[model samples]
Target: MRGQRRVWVAAGVLGAAIVAAGLWGIGGRQDAPRAAAQPAGIPVTLARVAHEDLTQNIDGVGTVTSLHSVLVRPQVEGLLTALLVEEGQMVEKGQLLATIDDRAIAAALEQAEATRQSNQAQLRIVEQDLQRYRTLSQRGSISRQILEQTEAEAARLRGTLRGNQATIEAERVRLSYTRITSPVAGRVGIRNVDVGNLLRTNDSSGLFTVTQMSPISVVFALPQETLPRLQPLLGGAAPVVAHSRDGGELLGEGHLNSIDNQVASSTGTIRARAVFDNPDGKLWPGQFVTVDLRAGVLRNGLVLDSRAVRRGLDGAYVFRIEEGKAQKVPVRIVQEVEGRSLIEGLAAGDEVVLDGHSRLTPGARVEIQGDAQALARRSQP
Candidate 1:
């Protein structure tokens, strides 16, 4: 009985020793990898939080629109005689664009002039006869009926002369319409009618379009809630900036020209326009762009590089460095533009991580990037 009990005790002791060794081995392996995984703290750059005035940039998508766009059409029906202007030609106000066949109008004007001359001659003859008849009637050499007939003839000839004169004026006005001129100063678009094509006033397709390019305007919409803020700055005082659709290039700069009187019921927004003196012709008609309207300034606020602001589950937060450790601080972003942001939670003089956030967590030890760089340079020599 004593030998069996001894054997059972020996087996139990060996089993306990094996279990202890296995646990120590597993724990040792874990500690080795843990120390190797993070031999040094995460290296990250830092940026200081500062307080300054930030300009509030209200961004929106807009389209470049011309203030004046006119579709050139013939005012009268006639065969297109000549195309004086070509497609894409820049023209001035009253500049000749095309001409209709004026030969018919010219012939009609000549005929009217001839009739006017004939009427004038007949009127002269009738007046002279009336004058002679009047003298004879006064001398009692003719009847009163004869004097009345002479006066009546003179009045009839005067009416004919007046009618002829009016016809001449009408013909002259029609003749002027034969020459088509641009009503506004602008660049002409595609030509719809070539020379020798008969054009009519009722033609559905117009001759072309004259679109003013310079002093151009961009039309955009803003939320209806912005009406009060936009109303007071509609006097061309608020500066407007335009960027390319990709926002890589600055298209032009201008000022707010006007705002819609009423908000659109369907869009819940109000329309506004900004005018630019597009001297370089960078702004083209019907081009889409991103607009930044300078509404106002945001007074004093905390400013930080936008890169430092990181989105977290709790909203926006920044990895602030304190005692060489990262502290995730929740922040409220007030305004963000370009590469800077105005935050509400953090105070001035707080250092936040600018980059190297791939392995960062709350309370993670961090090494200052500047200090690490200096140490590396010193060690190299």
Candidate 2:
């Protein structure tokens, strides 16, 4: 009777295991269908359009320089006697900066004046004698030949007087050169020569350097591909702002002063320059800076954030949202400025996806998380 009970227990356990297996398979199939039915929501952010003026700009590295720089050199050879100005002093035009030893020049000038006076006295004496000789010759008291000799002497004295007068004028000019003056209104650099130093005319080493910093110039080179677009704006009446190398600070505002006639062969860049009013003397000569060439406004254009524009096999494109799906629309970027891109082939009110574009494609369902109107409002004006 105990053996019969054991067999019955084993059969009951097997039948229970089969029933449990059947329930587990049914639950797994039911969960799989539920997971497949879940909706695939594309996480995305969107932006709306607004009307604003978009400017195209070219960025380049440049250098600051004084509009006018001059080297001070002595016009005549002499010993430097006195320095009237200190180094790095602001001087006005015609301000006396230094003085050379004028003793030799003064003595030469005096000698020339005395010689000129002597020649004038001798000329007067000769003239008086010639008149007397002519009168006597007409009265038959002196020979005509003698009168001719007196006349020749007077002529020679007059020539000598004229030559002496010219020499005196030249000597006076040389004497005036002893006082060296600033040729331009600017800040004077370090003096090359001290007191009692000998200097020469046309010396290779200059006495000092003067640079006019009230108005400064910033020069830069732009890629030649932008020449066509830049040529028109060059004639525009708007001013352009220049920023520092980091692009955070505004150095000054200036107009397009000049552009080079030819492009650089090595870099294919066209050289350009701008002039700024550096009244505070912030910009210095030879300082490297960043340049921004701002072209005038683009009217009635669509500008998208730089992050929205993407590159693909078909060229540049942006994932634009239409209805409830992401529509990858191909766009042609006309220009980029100030972290925004000016593009075509997009309407004014189209929605542009600003974030979560990696998995986006044509007809992909999207859910906009933020206020699209707020994004558009930020770019207004």
Candidate 3:
């Protein structure tokens, strides 16, 4: 019994020893990982904000419009014998565009001409008789009443000749109408009628349309609140520019033509037009484009790269670098020009992050790569 009790006590002691050894091994383990080292600062590009002369311009969407557009219609009713202009052909003012069958008009003109000639011949005979009668009266060989009667006959023949001449002029005008011409210098549009088609003055669809391409106009609108600034500039010949929607390509440059007399009630904007010399035909009619109207200049305006400005729940804000750390700074965007933004809150000489701002937070350590001010200093002589 004593030997068995000793054996059981030894077994309990052995088990406790093993369990304590395992616990010690885990507690004093030397292979465990250490706490992670602090992450390095976020790398970013920076630009030094500064005050510069910025143009206060208004940007808006605009539509291209032609200065003059006309529908070419025949003035006289006749069969279209010739089409002198083709679709999309540039034409000059008074250039012949079409020809009508003028045979009937020519016949009428010839008849009038013959009548005028016959009346002229009768007038000459009457004048000769009047002269002979006057000579006879002066010689006391014929009565004075007979001389006066011959004078009256000559005057009547002269009146008849004048009437025939007027008729001939009318026929000439009608004949001219058979040869249709462009009333303005422009590019011809689609042809509505072909040769052998009868054209009439009252035709709903005209022969064609002509649109003045060069020196074309663009119509746009701006907010009514901008009137105070735009109105003053309108009196002067302020310059306006048009660009592609992305603002990468310049469409054309022009000056303000006119502003609407009143603001639109529904839109709360005023319509305006600018005329551009479209010699290259870049600005086409009915094209929607971006319009930039230079109202005035804002001297000493704070500027920053447009990408630096970001929107959060609060509003527009920028990540500004201060003391090697990025700090959130609220900014009021006054204007955007040439891929840069004019901000209100930032001061001159302050640095702002341009790129890699997504991983930034307030008071975050930042390592700037492309510092614009630093590069400018390095470039200096």
Candidate 4:
């Protein structure tokens, strides 16, 4: 009876310990936290397609050239006596640029005039004698042949007088050539000759150069295919804007002046010229510039950010957001102006992805955070 009671007490203790461990495990399961669910959509920003008037432009690289360029040179040979204009001086048309020694020409002109006057006096005397001889011949005191010879002599003296007068005029013109003048209004370049330098008419170079800065011209070329579209804007004044090579500054604004008659066979391009009113002298001769030729404007066209348009093995496409999912939409790019693309195959109010497209695929869930209005607001100050 004592052994049986000891076994019952040990068994009771073991059973109580097991029951306590089971209760502790059940409480621990009830107290622990559950795992959170994964997000169903990706984070992305979306922008709505815009419909506005946009102008399409053709871009080209061109050089600023002078509208009027002249090389002042001596037409008569003499000692260069004076340089009236300094280097880099703005001069007007017909402005005196330089002078040569004119003493020799002046002296020759005077000699010619004196010879002409002396001949005129002798011709008058001859005319009087001829009249007397003609009257004497009528009275049979002088022979007919003598009268004829007197008349011939007077005619010869008149011819000689005419020749002398022509010589005087020639010398006068030669003297005028000694004074070199600017042929056109412009800023003068570096001086090639100094005062007292002997100049020749056949000099290969010139005394200096003058180039018109205001109302400058830019010469550029476009592919032959552009000529047809540019034809309508040719007769009329087409607008053109010029910028610095880096396109950071506005150089000037102008109109299309002319187009070449024939395309350059080697380049397969047609040359064009644009005129700018560079009153501030921003545009300079021989300067390389970026040219924008506004061909025409597309009215009420569907446009989007340039970055939204992507290229694949097929062509251009855009990732459009529809009902919280990305949908691939193929588009045709008509024109690109100022980072905005005029595209087809999309409505005016469609929402497209502007960025973060690499992580997106068709039917992929996305969370639209920003819209077009938000982007515009962020872009402003």
Candidate 5:
């Protein structure tokens, strides 16, 4: 009986040990899955934040325009006898551009002058006769009524002389109008009328178009938000530059000429104009261009790569690495310049995570792969 009891106890002990081993194995399998689910460390790319001058600028599209443009037209109606200026030729102000057939106008002027000279001679003779009549009446050699008649005749002759003189002056003015001259100093465009073409005073189409190309105007629009900052700088005499469509080449440099008084309600923008010396004729009227309004230098500002900035539920923030862990720092962006951001709430030297920000959380560990020198080189100056 004693041997059987000992056998049963031994069997019980072995069965208990087997059950415990199976439970341990099950727990180990569950824990293995959990361990695999958790990440070992957060993988991220980092960039060092440094200070640099951040230029706050606004960009917009604009068109080149001539400072002055005019359509050349004849002031009088006549046959076009001569065209002195060629198409696309430069002309000065008051330079004779064309001449109309002035033979009829000249003949009228000559006839008027001859009549005026005859009137002047008759007026002289009448004046002398009136003086002699007055003296004869005062000496009682002639009747008072006869002297009065002579005086009235003299006055009529004087009036006729004045009328003839006015006619002559009018004819002279009409003759001078036959010669067409440039109203301004500019380059002439294609001519619409050729020699022997009959031009009329009532015609609306001009003979040619002239434009001042040396000093050109550029008109551009700016967003309402950017206008306040730019308004103060515009008062200063500073140079602005325009770039090509690709932004690789500089089209020209100019100064802000004027700003519109009212903002555009529909677009929430303001129009501004600038003047450029286009001696090379690089800018032409109605040609679209890119405008850059350069605000003055910014001293001691913190700049970061534009990619480093991220939008969160709260606001704009950046991933700053502190003690090998990323901390989301809220920042206020002042401006964006050349693919970089000018921000507040950041110091001179801070390590910011530029890439892999989506996977990173506050207090998450980070691994910086490259040196600061490489990042510095990559940053825009």
Candidate 6:
């Protein structure tokens, strides 16, 4: 019975080994075909070369400034009686902004005027006497000495009248200073001196600041390297746009006005000013902003998406797609602005790869990803 059982076990082991070997051979055959198959083309996005006028803009940070900024300070010493305009009020040139105590100046003016009237009446009486004395001397009724003394009296009175007239004028000018007016057409700043406070001509703090807003100015700085390009745009109608510091919100539009005479040696930058007609009053002084100044335009430029231009060991180049294959083309970058690059060495309507450039090489096959909207914005001006 033991011999029969041992023979049966050996037969079962041999059958199991044969079935396992057959399964292993089938798995090897399936893997062999997959390893031999060629790789698929690299996925990429493409844009056609565009022939259009490409505008080049240089971007920099700037500050909103006022064209005319003046301190509204008192010209004479007096007690502040009233403030006609409130803080942050918009005022015109010569508009009354505040009033100082004018009683002292008015009293002095009245006193001078009264003295002038008295002197004038006395001078008239003396002149009549002098004229009669001259006529009497001619008729031999008055002595020559009397006529000369009368002439001297008339001259003295005339001098006193002239002095009085000058005092009255000086008093009038001092009285005018009591009424403070806006020196410029602009918005007022915070009041430094309150009503009923004493105001002095030499006060360190002024009453307020009046800054012109309608025609405001923006002062910005550009890199020294851009000086050559910036010189030609000065005094021209170079459009300047003021945007929020994040470069998203449109604040206002202006033009290049002036450039600083010398570049800042410490910062290697040049300061420039732009004038904007701020009709909407959106711009405020001391506000930081992003400025876009027109540098120049490329005529009939070979416009390519900025992403398509890649920097390699041999300088800038682009991978152009020709007949579904990436052909490496050397290019020169003229200008780049707003994600569009003005490039050379590519013809209009030629397609270039804008994305998935990592897997690209000369003559490598590519698979294009389609997007009408992206393609339109990428290439077309």
- Candidate closer to the true structure by lDDT (higher is better), 2 or 5: 5
Q: List the residue pairs that clash in candidate 3.
A: none
TM-score of each: 0.72, 0.82, 0.70, 0.80, 0.82, 0.77
Cα lDDT tens digits, model 4, 2-71, are: 9999999999999999999999998877665332233457877776787788898988999999999998
TM-score of 5: 0.82
lDDT (10s digit) by residue, model 5, range 22-103? 9999999999999986647677666667878776676788988888999877777899999998898988989999899999
Q: Residue by residue across 195-313, what tens digits does model 3's lDDT show?
A: 99988889989988999999999999999988887777765878999998787689999998898999999999999999999889999999999999988898888777787789888
lDDT for model 6 comes to 0.89
When summed lDDT is taken over every stretch of 10 residues in candidate 1, the lowest stretch is 372-381
lDDT of each: 0.88, 0.83, 0.86, 0.88, 0.84, 0.89
Which scores greater on lDDT, model 1 or model 6?
Answer: 6
Candidate 5 local distance difference test against the native: 0.84
What C-alpha RMSD separates each model from the true structure? Answer: 7.4, 4.5, 7.6, 6.2, 4.3, 7.1
For model 2 the local lDDT of residue 115 reads 90
Runs in model 5 deviating more than 4 A are 1-38, 140-163, 311-316, 361-364, 372-380
Worst 10 residues of 4 by lDDT: 31-40
The alpha-carbon lDDT assigned to residue 347 of candidate 3 equals 88
Q: Write the per-residue lDDT of candidate 6 for residues 187-291, one digit (tens) a residue.
A: 999989788898988997899999999899899999999999899987787999999999999999999999999999999999999999999998999999999
State how far residue 249 of model 2 sits from its true place (Å). Answer: 2.7
Q: How are the candidates ranked when ordered by TM-score, highest leading?
A: 5, 2, 4, 6, 1, 3
Candidate 2 backbone collisions, by pair = none
